[model samples]
Target: MTGVSRLDDPMPDSPSQTTPIPPVDGVLTMFYYNDLQAAADWYHRVLGFEKILIAEGLVLFRIHEGSQLALVGKGYGSQQPLAGTNKGAILSIQTRALQQWHERIASHEAEGIGHELHRGGNGRTVEFKVRDPEGYTIEFFEWVE
Candidate 1:
């Protein structure tokens, strides 16, 4: 008989074992705006996000599959006002397509939105910073693989 170690024994599978993780559904972002209507319009027209829900100065948009973006009216205390401005909070949005996202933001800038778009470190991502009508800053980014 050839010498063999118990360590070479075949492992048995268990019912508790699981494989193949599920993909992430989506992401959600919330923004506190003084004017929900303006925020909704900006996101819809400028960012190409479709409005999914709106109620009493609160608006929610479907930014992507299973992802939502929200605009909440002021006085909710979720955000603080910016220094010397009536707006508050900074929002960052991420995407996988940099060029396409940048073009969209650029179009908004061309319309005199007063926002700036720049390339991030290592040129792997492009970011656009825009202030809402209420002075809150929103940063949109597209990550390069």
Candidate 2:
């Protein structure tokens, strides 16, 4: 990952740059799936995530412009189980073409439409929720301008 070290590095910080030290640029939600290969394929096909690399039992994917998702085989690697069920944390992604994504996801499983395309978040966004192959929630939103 690219970084600038700190707001107070060796030299003086530049004003032309955005935030001195961005609280957080991107997020990589890593998880362990029962079958890494199948999980990778499902994410690639259904969720439209491209595989960046796969070695041993781990798989990395680019979920969006700034976010990523990494998956590992359950028994193939060492990792403490993440808490909660398939309905645990939601992976929210901002989209420019909500309608297109809606159609694509709905085609796979109509029931994945948990929130039934609606305008929410103080009417500032149009979004919907869907479950992945293993039941984790994935939310897609389009900012309302």
Candidate 3:
């Protein structure tokens, strides 16, 4: 056989064969909102997110480093609940600076607000939550270990 490798042949020994695949880079959570621009704007104002795109049926925002939140406009497809409710889901974030994150969220003024620091009974993590404009819950956490 010539030096050229065939498709059926095993690869010659090389570092590439043992290299690991890369880990996940980020996450994007989508929320259905009838008033898409308003929902995007409210998140931008309250949580310091910036608009990343205004594509067909969705407005994307960068909510944190490597994390995104999208507001779905009319005609977007989802198994979402009614326009203003999310009863069984939460957007949980892992953060290192819990206190600083709390300070930023607490600056916002809104109805149905929720914000408090909590320590798990066994003292493993610290966390807090703040409700979004449309009432979906977002939790932030940091491990004590």
Q: Which candidate ranks first by TM-score, i.e. highest?
A: 3
TM-score for each model: 0.59, 0.69, 0.70
TM-score for predicted model 2 compared with the true structure: 0.69
lDDT of 2: 0.75
* Model 2 CA deviation exceeding 4 Å by range: 1-19, 22-26, 76-78, 81-87, 114-116
Tens-digit lDDT track for model 3 on 61-132?
A: 887778898888756766453655555677787789888878887777644444678985256678877777
- What are the RMSDs of all candidates, in order? 10.9, 7.9, 11.3
Instruction: Looking at model 2, report the run of 10 residues with the lowest lDDT sum.
Output: 1-10
Reference-based lDDT, each prediction: 0.66, 0.75, 0.74
Please give, for residues 1-145, the per-residue lDDT of candidate 2 as tens digits.
1443433365445663644664778888877777577768778888778889888878999987768898878766567435445545677888898889998888777346853689977777899987666666778898776
The residue-level lDDT of candidate 3 at 74 comes to: 59
Better of 1 and 2 by lDDT: 2
lDDT-better candidate, 1 vs 3: 3
The digit string of per-residue lDDT tens for model 1 on 30-81 reads: 7776666776788788778888887875788896688787787776546632
